[model samples]
Target: MQGRSIPAPNDWAAQFWSPIVGAEAQATRETVAMYDMTALKRLEVTGPGAAAFLERLCTGKVAKSVGSVTYTLLLDHDGGIRSDITVARLARDRFQVGANGNLDLDWFSRHLPADGTVQVRDITPGTCCIGLWGPLARKVLQPLTDEDFSNEGLKYFRAKRAYIGSVPVTAMRLSYVGELGWELYTTADQGLKLWDTLWQAAKPLGGVIAGRGAFNSLRLEKGYRSFGTDMTYEHDPYEAGVGFAVKLDKDDFIGKAALQRRKSEVRRKLTCLTIDDPHSVVMGKEPVYDGGRAVGYVTSAAYGYTIGKGIAYAWLPAELAVPGTPVRIGYFDQRIEAVVAEEPLFDPTMSRLRG
Candidate 1:
């Protein structure tokens, strides 16, 4: 499990573990791929006030039944996007929060109620995660355990406690790469065994151990936004292209009033651009020009191996965000031609993910 490694955003893991990222990216599309997602911050929220506390802070409904997962956002008072997180209700009084990083942990810790009815604990150090995804993900996993991994048995956005071989795991039916899969979690002591078990089972099925490089390319193709790279506190859910996660009809939550006021006033947006030339690519933070004037900058960019084009997400004026609007990205000495394209560039119908 070694190759050329690069520094990741988090200090605990490498940006990539393999040299050939394209092959890994292809594996995720054509077959199964295992990703080391241990760098993802994991948190445990428990106590009598767990559901109420989370519902107050999250924009989406968090007070759901056990084994349910909700993709939600943590917003600031000004309706700015703080973090996009997933809240999994493990029990009546317990939740597993899949969050960004230390900043999210700090945000949750700072907002704890004075009555001490809720407890937030960092669980990253004690837990590890493996993201097994692709068309054959269920095939690779089903034989290892008795638990039903079928679409009907463990549906999307759901969580179930199960065992993979001898390793106890909590499997969440979700995918960052827009593929059919589950994020399998286990204790640190069982991490090695879990990885080995999956790898051995998937070997005959043509599964590859992928890295962050392929993961980034896959997610961008799916139009998934990374918290810090594609958005920040300055952007709102609408402008960030994640307004679907915001439920204004729900009861009072953080930034509810501000979001209501800002909903109809969006002036800018995180727009998707596709390079005209399939070979041309930008490395992000490059200036984007509308006509002759620079109007925005690229936030995240990757070569869409699956789509046979270059993809970049950039911040642009609302008028320039329309599909088919032409733009140019300044990459060092060259200005590459691109156009505002409808996302996600791949799997717009999400049939692959649902299967």
Candidate 2:
């Protein structure tokens, strides 16, 4: 998190993380399989005090029992989401934090203690990650590791040590897939080797290599919030309806007070909307209207293939967030028709996690 200049769009983020392939090929669709966020500075927190520091600073508990990949929000004293990160608990003494935005990396760096019992290091250059998703994901991955994924305890937010070739790895049941998937995390030197290894194992399952665009579509369809986009420092967990990730009952933590107060005082809330017309898509920052008055603005909008329509997340007034509320989203010259609906246009019951 050295405040390097932001990377230009379509840069070689994947190559930096997984250096097995040539830069040109890594930047392309064959090996990368998705958008390259490898440019995001990686930070490693380890040693005796890391867990205690995280428990006080982050929304989720970072203790040993919950040593799995978890979604957490870093907040200021005022309870806004400064960064939404995925915490990968590698072991009792080590953990990794993956963030979507660079600013959060700086935020975490500034807060570390000077005594050094808890240490933080930038490991972006040394780590590589690839996500295997879709229905056949687990079946495709079973051959690469010796652990039994079919074991009942290999549930979501869980992980265990495994190996591919000679390199040690941590296979975590974490993904944006809304389906059964795993994130293969290992050293940078072995990144491409692991990717090629997995590709060979996964090809027989008819697995489609996923890209950033498709990954974004799948996540947004499930109403997952993207850091710096759909969610920001201005929004609290309560309004985002991610309260499960925030354990208010736990011992004191940062932003706990503000979150408790904001629970009932939220004026506008994040909710999902579907365009009445499938052909009409509502883009972000479009004005959302009720009658002649503009009540809210669209934060994230996309065409959902599963629901077969335009779906979006908007910060609508709490009263207007009802399931049947009629709203309109504006385009350049024409306004698109839409309605407010409960988020998660697909599988509200969360059935896909079991598949």
Off by over 4 Å in 1: 1-19
lDDT of 2 at 216: 58
The parts of candidate 2 lying over 4 Å away from their true place are 1-41, 151-153, 165-167
Question: What is every candidate's alpha-carbon RMSD to the true fold?
Answer: 4.8, 8.3
Taken over the whole model, the C-alpha lDDT of each candidate is: 0.91, 0.70
Candidate 1 lDDT over 279-318, as tens digits, reads 4657789999987899999999877778877789999999
Assess every candidate by TM-score.
0.94, 0.86
Q: Which 10 residues in a row give candidate 2 its minimum summed lDDT?
A: 1-10
Best by TM-score: 1
Query: Among all windows of ten consecutive residues in candidate 1, which has the lowest summed lDDT?
Result: 4-13
- Deviation in Å, model 2, residue 301 alpha carbon: 1.4
What number of clashing residue pairs does each candidate have, in the order they appear? Answer: 0, 0
